[model samples]
Target: MWIWFHKLGSPPHFYRTAGRLVPWFGIPALLLLVAGTVGGLAIAPPDYQQGDGFRIIYVHVPSAYISMFGYVAMAVAAAVGLIWRMKVAFAFAAACAPVGAAFTFLALATGSIWGKPMWGVWWDWDGRMTSVLVLFFLYVGVMALRSAFDDASKGDRAAALLAIVGVVNIPIIKFSVDWWNTLHQPATIAKLSAPSITMDMLVWLLAMVVGYTLFFAAVVTMRLRGEVLLRERGARWIRELNAHA
Candidate 1:
């Protein structure tokens, strides 16, 4: 297991393996996104209370879910890099930042769009909303801290530390509504035995969530390829690969 882990942490190996894996993730992502979109927007019945506006959940919920997933992925990779001195792990963490930030932004935007009609306000400092906003800032902070350093090693260490520390917010974001009296509703599908949502809605929501995850995987894996190249630009393998090109 450790042998495979070591090999995976190698820049050349990750670049080659991840390149081949992109289509696997991307193809499924495209199919699921298409199916989820159609099912949620056209096939599913309108919400009993919110009516058609709830359709935005098809986009908003998935984006919000994926944003948290990306943060956790980045933090774990950063920790691996810090513990084992794995350059590829550090590159993977850096690659996750932008993709996570973009999805966080999308989640916030869609949430606001959904909120205007439902809550009678464009924005509110609800616990979940506030915490998610904080999450977005954390993502930005990690990226900014990384680039702030002129030395690559210094940048990686700084970014890794921040990523690890920021993980505390993940739990805060998850349980924010339960922890506070907020206008934002509690999760609908959290109750496994008796979910508040119907199968028609639940199925598509899960599909969208899975699709978003695969989409993130596809983007981050591609981004990691560039990151690995940048981190290993002077390596013999990179030199030989470029020569062949």
Candidate 2:
């Protein structure tokens, strides 16, 4: 296990391996996304209360879930990089920032669209909403901080530290709905017992979540490969690979 972990940290190995693995994640993600969209929008019965407006959950919930997932993943990678001094891990954390930001934006945008009909307002200063906006800004801040320093190592460490420090927001984002009176609905899928949602809707929602995760993996892997090449440009193996290309 240690050997494989070290191998994954190696630039050439990770680049080659990620290239080969992209299709595995990408194809399944696309298929599941299509399936989930069709199932949620077309097959699943309308919410007895919200009707078709609730169908936005197919996009909103997954994006919001993934926004948090991306932050956790970024923080973990940042921690690993800081502790182990692994360039690959730093690259991964950097790559995750933009993707996570995009998902956060999607979540906020969809939530606003869903909110207009439900809450009769497009924007609110509620806890859940405000925390997520902060999370999005965190992603942007990390990326900006990373590019602020001329020294690459300093930039990586700064960004990593920021990511680790900012992780506290994640739990706050998760429990904000419960901790305070908010417009956002409480979680229906993540529960100790049976989910509040029906099986049909649950199935599609779960599929979208999985699909979004896999899609994130596919994109991050692709970005990591590019990052590896950029960072390793002066290395002999990268030169050889580039020469061949």
Worst 10 residues of 1 by lDDT: 186-195
User: Looking at candidate 2, what is the lDDT of residue 98?
Assistant: 96
TM-score of each: 0.98, 0.98
Clashes of 2: 0
Question: Model 1, 1-245: lDDT tens per residue?
Answer: 99999889887888899999999999999999999999999998999999999999999999999899999999999999999899999999999999999999999999999999999988999899999999999999999999999998789999999999999999998888888999889887764568788898889998999999999999999999999999887999998888887
Point to the candidate with the largest lDDT: 2
Best by TM-score: 2
**lDDT values for all models:** 0.93, 0.94
